[model samples]
Target: MSRGKHARRRANRNRATLEGEVAALTAQLVRERKRLDQARAGARRADTAQARLTAETAAAARVMAPVEAEATQTAAAVGPACTVLTEAARELARCDARLSRAAGRSADPARLRTALNTGVRAHLDSVHRSAPLEYHHAAFRRRRGVDTPLCRTLNVGGWIPPEIAGTDHDRIAAHMASRAGEHTRAALWCWAVPPWMGLPDGTDAPGRRTALGATTTGAPDLPDGEFGGRLRAGAVVGTPWRHRPLVALPEDAVDLAYWYRRSAWTQNWHPHTRPVPFWLGDEHAHGFPRSQPLPPGTDRRLPFPAVIVVFESGWQLPARHPDPPDTRAPTGLLYARGHGPTTPPLEQPLYRLAPGTRRDELATPLELVDRYGATVEGLIFTADPDGHPTDEFAWCLAIHHPWGLPLGRITIPASRRATHWTTAIDNTLAGVCLAHFHPTATSTGSPGADPSSANAEPHARDDADVHVLDIAATSPTTGSHRTPAHAAGRAAHLRRATWRYQPVGPGRQHRRWTWVRATIVGGRASSRSTVYRLTDT
Candidate 1:
């Protein structure tokens, strides 16, 4: 019994110790689990941090990519020329637009060409006053013939009459022919819209008065103008007023000038007495037939020959304007008997229309030409008047001889008239004579003239090709002259009729002879032709 009680006591002690150890182990396990959970949480946070860092790095690369690309492009696109190119592009755009607009407008080609030349004309007076080299040296050393002052300019072609041409435009050939006379005048024709050209009131117009207009030349029909003033769009091709040779005026408006001369080459002026007139919609064909094309300037067949004119004019005191020899004193007896007290003969009178003269008449003279030198002058200039906008002016031109132009003496029967022209040949004879004629519808129909043969053989003289000289057509002879094509069809016939002289020697011949060639052009081929013989040398 005593042994059994001691065993029970040992068992109880062992149980208590085991229970305490179990509690201590449980606490240790709990602490370890807590530590492990904290470590696991830290690892998860580290993974999230790594992922965020990787995302940020990728975003930063994306943000920098476009900037880098732009920087590269900028570097490639420039050094320093970029600014210049940009500015140049802007300027070019502006200039191109301006040029395009100018080209589109229906402007006179001549005026457009002379845009720069206008500066010269506008400032010619100032330039002359400075006594530049052009003024002093350009006169070909020819004296300014005070003794026999002569101012002359060649006349440009005129508009074809509406009655004959049915339009404003005439053939280049016909335009040149009509104004070939030595005394041809210069006048330009213009058209008017509903609003006619208007002139300021009270301005004097030197015109032959009509029974109706003498008192009725009153107010503008329309406030804008009487006739729509600006030249019809595309009405004419060349400058509205063909090359108007600028006149050298004095610096002071009223100052007198000394005699001046110009022996210089120039295109001749056109008649200003009456320019060719036209309505708004006239059928004026501006083309030449294929057979007879207008030749280049190099051709001798040109109607208007290149010429050097000896133009001279100026105000001068008479060589001897001695006060009429004091009629009451010394030469009274002779002066009174022969001629009544000669009121000191007036000086050579210069003629120009009063400044503000306006006209709508076709026949009245726009300019005056007397014996004293006054050749080409504009009567009135309109910068911007009613109806007409582009600069316009009336002109007076004189047709005269150029230096070295061959002189001719022609004799034709009164019934069969012909226009005559002459040009000198190289020391062979005096000159070649040309006769102009229009088509005459005859009963006997003639063959079609193959004038291509005429141009086939070109004569060479003095290292230059000698081409056919020209003669202007005369006024209508018989046929109802219509289009330029019709006129060109009836060309005058040509066959050389050389008049020979006495053969004096081998080289020199004693010949006062005449020459004639009957030229056939247009469609008019004739069976026979009348010949004219040049007489005077």
Candidate 2:
């Protein structure tokens, strides 16, 4: 009970005191932390309010700026005219507003007229003019109208201003008619089919040309003119409407007429040069036998994606005559060469369509051929494979390979012949072809490719591989004044427009191949999609 017991009691009391102090301090710290959190939340609210107010202030300033600027301008314009009469002051204000609008938004008439004149000049340069005067004296005289009595008498050629001629359809007709004689002018064109089987030996008979079955005929009345009979092999048939004739050499009588229509139609519309015959090389025409042997020394390996053009002959009236007219424009067979396989053209859907069943319901040229039984024909006007950059045909041909698979043949029924294809349709074809030929070429997934795939590449545009070639345009008809020059100028005005991509995939494949549809319009594409894959039945 001594000094040790007293020391233990004192130590316990000290420990209890220390515990009370620690509890008090912990409570105070909790209160302080709560206060800090509340303050921070309030600060966040204030910041949000400040940001909203700043946005509102900026919006108000923007709204006021235009009014303030107009007021300042009005004040400046009213200087020194403060005492002017009310009417005069009002007039000044109107004039100032007009000046602002003209400077900012309105088109200048002078600039527009200058642009039009430039286009006309460019057009005239492209047109084929009569041969330059043979002699210097003749050239001088011709310039003065000494040699152009017809031009002077008819008041055509350069005599009539283009403004008047272009506006007045009748005057344009007269101007064109005056340049060419009635005898030379084509009344109606004929597509004389060559007898590919007439050879003594059947060695060269590429089974009946599958593509040549498209006999385009119109039900309309025949134009009033002599339908020229079969001409000699060397004789030229188709002379353009006005310009000098560009002759096409044919190997046989039927070939002569076919070239005649080709030359005539091309010259009348294009009038720039001869149609370059593009041959499908051996690789492209592998399974399809040769109707006639390739031209001597002609390379069989070159890739010419151009298809044969089948034009509707005015002489053959399918509606009137059950069988194609045999007397004048004989029903000719067109053979399309195939690259991959040799299939029976007659067994294809195009040839197997129910008799008298026309494809009026199908929308695309390809659909008409593959689904509804149509035949393929090449383009009427052959474009130079290595022609000018802006040449519509050349551009189409050059880009076709990259954009899509070869349009082996084009299809159209005798009943549903069209002038041209729409821009959307043409773009769709490009997309379909691109999807088939260069499936991975586009940034956008190829048609029918899985969209959600992690490995799928990005797409640059929604249109996939389609690109705008030119605006839709029509070629000049028999008496129309439209020149190749005008077509070229119009093409320049075309702005790019996007066509949405439509997926054409394995579902759209066909067994037999077809060609690209050819139309009379200048820039519009009316091509059929050729079957890329053939399924064994």
Winner by lDDT: 2
Residue 499, candidate 1: Cα error in Å is 7.7
TM-scores for all predictions: 0.15, 0.18
lDDT of 2: 0.30
Top TM-score hit: 2
Superposition TM-score, candidate 1 onto the true structure? 0.15
Off by over 4 Å in 2: 1-186, 189-257, 260-267, 285-386, 389-391, 394-537
Model 2 TM: 0.18
Steric collisions counted per model:
43, 20
Worst 10 residues of 1 by lDDT: 256-265
